[model samples]
Target: MSLFARLAFLMLCTVIPAFALASVAVAGSECPAVDANDTQARNSLMYYVCYHQSSPGEPAHTALNPAELPEHIKWTPSQGHELVFSQTRSVYWIRLNIRNNGSERRLWYLNLHYPLLDEVTFWRGDQPEDVLVTGDQHRFGSRLVDYRYFLLPITLNSGETRSITIRIHSSGALNIPLKLETPEEVIAESNHLAVTHGLFYGAILVLAIFNLLLFFSSGTTYYFYNALYMVAMGLFLFAMGGFANQYFWPENPKFANTSIPLTLALCALAMTFFGRSFLEVAAHTRADKTLKAILWICAGFTGLTLAIPYSQAILINTALGLVIIFILSIIAISRWQQGYQPAKWYVLAWAIMAVGALVYAAAAFGYLADFLARESLMQVAIGGQVILLNYAMVQRWRLLNDKLLEVEQKARNDLEYKVHERTAQLRSTMRELENANRKLATLSLNDSLTGLYNRRHMDNILPDLCAEARRTGRPLTIALLDADHFKAVNDTWGHGFGDTWLQLIADILTRHATRPRDTAVRFGGEEFALLLPSTDLEGAQKVCEAVLEEIRTTSVEAPGGAKARLTMSAGIATLLPNENQQEFFERADSALYEAKAQGRNQTVIADT
Candidate 1:
């Protein structure tokens, strides 16, 4: 052979084994070999079969496929003797063809996870068992096993096909058959995922319920918005195959496709409304209005997607809308940092919700892939959003309470200031009135000559005194006294001497009064009057006689150094009950006239 031909043969020898190994790895060993004549049978098979040997190091059995498994097919870790694969799909009839190429007899039993959905039974040669072999060894005695068999049952010889017929019901878990090999480790891992999913969904539900309660209790727009937002977040988590379906309603798959877009739209609406209220954005600037308009447009598009029945369109729009929301959240945060105190909480809450929404949107749009056994990231994000929003709401409530208290305190302070001002004004007015009273008392009722009660005081108090005398049946009397020949004295000693004489007489009358209730007034000119409450006619006459004698004998020094004699006449009268001041004064005057007519130095009393 030539050198080129030998090199080609060596290359072929090396490449052929590699190709064979690659093919075996891609397609499992249990996969049926394709034949040119069996095109129809090849086209009908939905899944390729692969197998691994059972050994001490390896698990009992394993299958490998290049195509990725669905999210629901992921395994969880749990301890159980039996394993079942359960799934729900719109497509009908799943075909399972197992090729047992092992030499040893294998004893296996099959039990449906949801047994009420269907009955499955295996055919053995020409005879089929009425009851299927179910592994219930714990309930049945070991010696009385119902359908015990090795890998090769006596009823099935080598190279014979044994088929099991599964009849599916149309609703709930009954809608699909559970297919799995016994004692598989994948079932345990899947159960753990299912449990975690349930817990996550429960947490979302609790947050939603709590927010709803707060909304009703407070009636604040923030609480209302948060409630709606939390509810949407919870539904989104459920739709994403989180705790909701795993624990609460695992059998139903209808909500899986519908809740994602619906929740996204609702959350967007809630956040927009919340921003408007919490930040008081409408009051601050016009940017809030633009955001609101955009949110509404997004909502309209989401509704249109729902109505159109196109899943891909809905998913795409949902992703875009969520991105817009995240941008809005960043803008809101920037505004808050710029000194809007209320905006701080709003931005923080929205930021958390944005992260949750993005995670869910990524999962929905196939932007991120997740394993089955992992807890749903969307559900965790919803929980985070709920916590953040609740915190924001609490801060908002505290801020509002503080504002209300400040307003009330301000109002109270204002009212107190007004009251203080008014009280000060009233006190000033009262002081002015008291000063006027003092001045009036000095001018109208005080005697200029002797600082004693004047005739004006008599006029002010005499009527009340007479009325009191009548009521109490007490004696009331008056004495009218006049300085004698006051004109002659004024001519001889000048007016100053005459004034001195009059002042002396007023002082004498005031000082000589018998009781505290007695009042002496400078009547006018050289005249003076004395009022005695509780004094009768006899008592007044005696007091007047004493006053007359004292005035007659008293000597007054003139201003020019000459001595002068001063004398006075007195007229005494007792008050009559129920009489007018005029009548009382007339009686006193008549007595004074009689005294002057009889003599200038004597005292006289009027007849009753």
Candidate 2:
């Protein structure tokens, strides 16, 4: 048989016997019919006596009539033991035998208690042989389903007997007493197994709490769903009797029976919810709807099982349905892997959960028994599922964080690019503005017609030169020149030819005035001035003579295809320490009038 089938078989075998024992009843009349004094009175009334045999390879057996057995088969009851029988009793009594069949020596004990009477006792015997009584004496505690067997060993030889006696006393009446048998070794093994299972359960609980704290801190949907998932799975592990309760509530026998299936159902539901949210399934694809439907179906079936209690049938159907759903999940994962992005994590997580589920199912069904020290194979399955789901949650978080970083980086890069582009544009505009400003400055200070400094430029420089000459006690000269008969030339040759003649004279005067500090200006119509720094009247006269010679030699072309010769009359004046610019210019004007009177083609100097 498959592991799942074997597990189911074992579970049915174990659980059915418990149910039958719990339901057994005693006949009231049969209890009184047996002689209280006779040793066989209890045996005759006891319809069945079940016990673990001391020999290896012995199948569990029950005797219908213990009174007819040989001396070795019958065990003497303890003092004041009353075996009562009734048809309506709710508990059964049993005897178990323990033997040390291994090479190592071992200790054994029989544990039985009557909660109704508040009494507990232990029976110890030798290694060769013994018998033990283990049952509820007064119908207290939870109703006894079956007797437990314990193996307590200090030392024993191979094939030695580790046995004890158990006298079952009943408060309620029962006609036929049923027997429950289990090896002492099996019970000891179970306790140790419970301890290990409990530890694993604690681990899962811690993980759940950690994730929950993370959820509150981060406020992320992923952390919230992950926390829920871990809590659900943790509860499922606890319900399965893996961890804490084994040490604390081991006597609360109904915990695993009642809570295991319910927790599993709820866990599956929570996992479905977690998967949807973590994968962003609804936003990403229509497959989320299908998953929801599957979740609903599983939930519905689980609810039905809870609402209607039945023995084994409900459990079987639920398990089978879950198995089918798991198969479908596998197929869905294959399909999801083809194209869905979120499915990458969803499918991987489900795959691991699916395998864990299968292993759990196998153990639940009694298909494969656990050989481990502290837990059943099913508990291991639960632990595995918890780990895989946790890892998957982390993976989902990482994927989201990576995507967020990518978007932020892109935004930053785009912003930088725009800033750089704007900077380049601003630089281009600045260069254009600088060029225009330079041209404006040139136009403001230069004469357009004569290509010489304008009167405004000369007026601004002359004051600075005057101040410097007075401070340094240097000679400064100002010379005024006027083209003689310039108006008559314009009349004869047209104003255009007159303009050409004036341009020629301006060029000659500018070229002949050869000092860095000299100022040449277009003073007015047919009038010009040159200011010379660091020069006396004599130096000024020499500069004026050069100007007069150049002006006389230079010829201009008239607009009417005629040639014209130009000459200018010059007047020079020197500045004294006390002479102002107006006084100096008046003196130069008088000299220029003298030169014009003297026939206007020569230079003249002002009287010192």
| Candidate 2 Cα deviation (angstroms), residue 213 | 2.3
Candidate 2, residues 304-409: lDDT per residue as tens digits? 5465432343254435445544544554475466554455555655665555555544333323233121124545655665666676666666766676455333
**TM-score for all models, in order of appearance:** 0.40, 0.40
State the displacement of the C-alpha of residue 324, model 2, in Å, after optimal TM-score superposition. Answer: 7.4
Model 1, span 1-608: residue lDDT tens:
22332233233222221111112222221334222123343233223222221222322212111122232232221111111111222212222343333344332232233212222223222343432332111111121222211111222223333433222222211112122333332346347655875677677677767867776755555667766766675665454443333344434434433445566667667666666666656553567667777678767866865664324434444555555566567667766777766566666666665565554443232233231211255556556656666676677667766765553332232244543555444322433544554576578778776777777778877887788899899998988988778899988888887877877777677667858678888878888899998998888888788787777888977676767898888888888867887788788888887988997788878888
Which residue runs of candidate 2 sit more than 4 Å off their true CA positions?
1-195, 242-256, 283-286, 310-321, 324-328, 331-349, 371-376, 379-384, 409-608
Worst 10 residues of 1 by lDDT: 14-23
lDDT of model 2, residue 552? 82
